[model samples]
Target: MDFKELLKELKGNLLSLMGSKFDELKDESKKDVQAFLNASKEKLERWTTLLAEGNITVSDYKWLVESQKDLVVLKGLYAAGVSKIKLGHLKNSILDTVIETAIGFVKPNKDDDNEATV
Candidate 1:
């Protein structure tokens, strides 16, 4: 598949995963999770469209990756924020893992680097 298609597929998968994770939260945490999911969905849509339209440069991809990383961090913070209200260690663990996995997707791969540090 082409880069745009790959990015689109990735975005879809991430959204699906985020939705599933949000569903696992208790009612009290649902609102925050929903908000996060909505924001993430919007960002993913924008990035995917830009990629598909060939409007994304290498720098844009880098920015996308960074933005995704920030989102993953936000997810983690949201999980922590709701940990008290959620009232379950298992749920907390699941949320943590989901955030970690999401972060992993956009993280820079060691093999993808071409620069040598001075």
Candidate 2:
């Protein structure tokens, strides 16, 4: 898996999620992803390798991704007065994006039938 590319896609998808208002929290968008990286980088690398090597189920990978939910505070947006409900949804959405993008970059082993784990 190409981590750099995966990160790029994640940031792009995040910005897109913001639509035309993307610029509103430009630093937060960048920081959100950076925070995710700072917190999840090693784990993500290991997990992606396991995933690609057919060593873990996709569900397991997703769960592992979800475990890092605390890392993305989106504090700038929150401080900017985005509602708790909206921020909650946005947080979930960001996590979902991470899962999707990481999975997209992983070219799993052909034999991986989602029945494996380390």
Candidate 3:
């Protein structure tokens, strides 16, 4: 695929991941949710700055996608590690469903060819 297609896929994947993560937070205890929100806001600020600076190369984008996946796995592990934690299984499953839906929306359509080519 071309760069634009790759970017679309990446955006879709990121959105799906973020949506699921948000859904999971929604079912968390108020204190846990608040802490996660604070952390997410900080991380989002950094991501936005990086995006605005146009500092990411293709390799960097690849690394970012992989890192996000790793983070998801880490979160699952961390949740599992807790001895007496009340996990939100239903919310977590719904988050997984959201990711699947997001992935389904990533394909490019024919109308994308409207731009003038060099």
Instruction: Give lDDT per model, in order.
Output: 0.44, 0.72, 0.36
Q: For candidate 1, which ten residues in a row score worst on lDDT?
A: 109-118
TM-score of each: 0.34, 0.78, 0.29
Q: Any runs in candidate 3 off by more than 4 Å, and if so which?
A: 1-33, 58-62, 65-118
lDDT of 2 by residue, 68-100 (tens): 878778777777777878878887887787777
Candidate with the greatest TM-score versus the true structure = 2
lDDT of 3 by residue, 17-63 (tens): 44464545433333343343334334433443443344543234333
**Which pairs clash in model 1?**
none
lDDT, candidate 1, at 105: 43
Instruction: Give the true-structure RMSD of model 2.
Output: 3.6
lDDT for model 1 comes to: 0.44
Q: RMSD of model 1, in Å? A: 8.4
Candidate 1: count the clashes. 0
